[model samples]
Target: MENSIQSIPQNWYLILSSFMFCIGIMGVLFRRNAIIILMCIELMLNAVNLLLVSFSSYAGNAEGQVFVFFIMVVAAAEVAVGLALLVSIYRNIASTDINILSKMKW
Candidate 1:
C-alpha cells in the first residue's frame, strides 16, 4: 500500500502549483491594498517553489532544487525592497491605498 501510494505520478504537484498560482494572480489583480498584492506575489513564488522541489525530488535532479534556492534568494530580496517601498509610501501619504497613491506628489 505504501509503495502504491508513493507510485503516483508527479503531475498532481504541478496541478496544485498551477491552482495556487492562479489564485495568487487573481488576488493581485483584484485586491487594492499594496501589502495584499505583495503577499499574493509571494504566494505565487512559493507555489512555483513547491512545484520545483516536487519535480526535483521525483526526478532525482539537483538542478531544480538549485533553482529553488535562487528563487528563494530573489523572493527574500523582493520582500525587503517591497516592504521598504511600502514603508516610504506610508510615511509620505499615511495611507496604503493603491489608488490614492497615484494622486500624491513628492
Candidate 2:
C-alpha cells in the first residue's frame, strides 16, 4: 500500500498538464471576449503550476512548490489589474470584446 501511493506514473501528469495547456491556448486564440481570454490565461498558468507540483512531488523537493506559490501570487496580482482595466474599458466602450480595444487611442 505504501508503495502504491507513490507509484503514480509521471506520464499521467504530463499528459494532463499538456492537455490543459492546449485547451487554454485554444481558448485564448479563438475567444473574442476579454474576460474569457483572461480566464484562459489563468488556466494556462494553473496548468504550469500543476506540472511544477507533479515534478516537485516526484523529485522529493520543495523548490517547485515554492515557485508555484510565487506564480500564484503573481497571477493574483495580474487578475486584479486585468479586471480593473476591463472594468474601466467596459465603462468607456460598453463592451468586453477585444477587437473594440484596437480602436481605442489616447
Candidate 3:
C-alpha cells in the first residue's frame, strides 16, 4: 500500500496545483463581488499550500511544511482584516460589489 502511494508521480501534483491556481486566477479576474474575489484569493493560497506540501513530501524535507504553516497563519490574518474591510464597505455602501468601491471618497 505504501509502495503504491509512493509510486504516484510528483508531476501529477504539480499539474493539479497549476490547474487550481489558474482557476483561482480566473475567478479573481472575472468576479465582481468582493466576497467571491476573497474566496478566489484563498483558493490560490490553498493551491500554493498544496504544492508546497507535495514538494516537501517528495524532497523528504520539513522546510516546505513549515513555510506552509506560516503562510496559513498569514492567510488567516489577511482574511480577518479583509472580511472586516468588506463588512465596513458593505455597511457604508449597502453593497459588496467591487466596482462601486471606486466611487468611495473620504
Candidate 4:
C-alpha cells in the first residue's frame, strides 16, 4: 500500500495546485471590491495549503499537516483583521471599491 501510494507522481499534484493558484490569481487581479479581493487571497492561500498537504502526504510526514494548521490560524486572523479594517473604511467612505481605497494613501 505504501509503495503504491508513493508511486503516484508528485507532478500531478503540482499541476492541479498550480491550476488552482492561477485561478486565484486571476480572481484577485480582476475583482474590484475589497471583500472579493480578500476572498481571492483566501483562495490563493488554500491552493498553497493543498500543495503543502499533498507534499507532506507524499513524504510520509506529519509536518505538512502541522504547517497547514498554522496557516489556517494565520488566515483566520487575517480575515478577522481584514474585515474589521474594511468596516472601518466603509464607515468613512461608504464604499468597498478597491480603486477608491487609493485615497487612503498616507
Judging by TM-score against the true structure, name the best candidate.
3
Candidate 4 per-residue lDDT, tens place, 1-106, comes to 7476577799988998889899989998998999998998999899899899998988889999999999999999999999999999999999999888785688
lDDT score for residue 63 of model 4: 97
Looking at model 4, the pairs that clash are none
Query: lDDT for each of the candidates?
Result: 0.92, 0.95, 0.95, 0.92
- Model 4, runs deviating above 4 Å: 1-8, 104-106
| Candidate structures ordered by TM-score, highest first | 3, 2, 4, 1
Worst 10 residues of 1 by lDDT: 1-10
Using TM-score as the measure, name the better of candidate 2 and candidate 4: 2
TM-score of each: 0.87, 0.91, 0.92, 0.88
| Residue 38 CA displacement from its true place in model 1, Å | 0.4
Alpha-carbon RMSD of each model: 3.1, 2.4, 2.3, 2.3
Q: Which 10-residue window in model 2 sums to the lowest lDDT? A: 1-10
Candidate 2 Cα lDDT to native: 0.95
- What is the Cα-based lDDT of residue 85 in candidate 1? 99
Please provide, for model 3 over 7-94, each residue's C-alpha lDDT reduced to its tens digit, 9 standing for 90 to 100.
8999999999999999999999999999999999999999999999999989999999999999999999999999999999899999
Please list the residue runs of candidate 3 whose C-alpha ends up more than 4 Å from where it truly belongs after superposition: 104-106
TM-score of 1: 0.87
TM-score of 2: 0.91
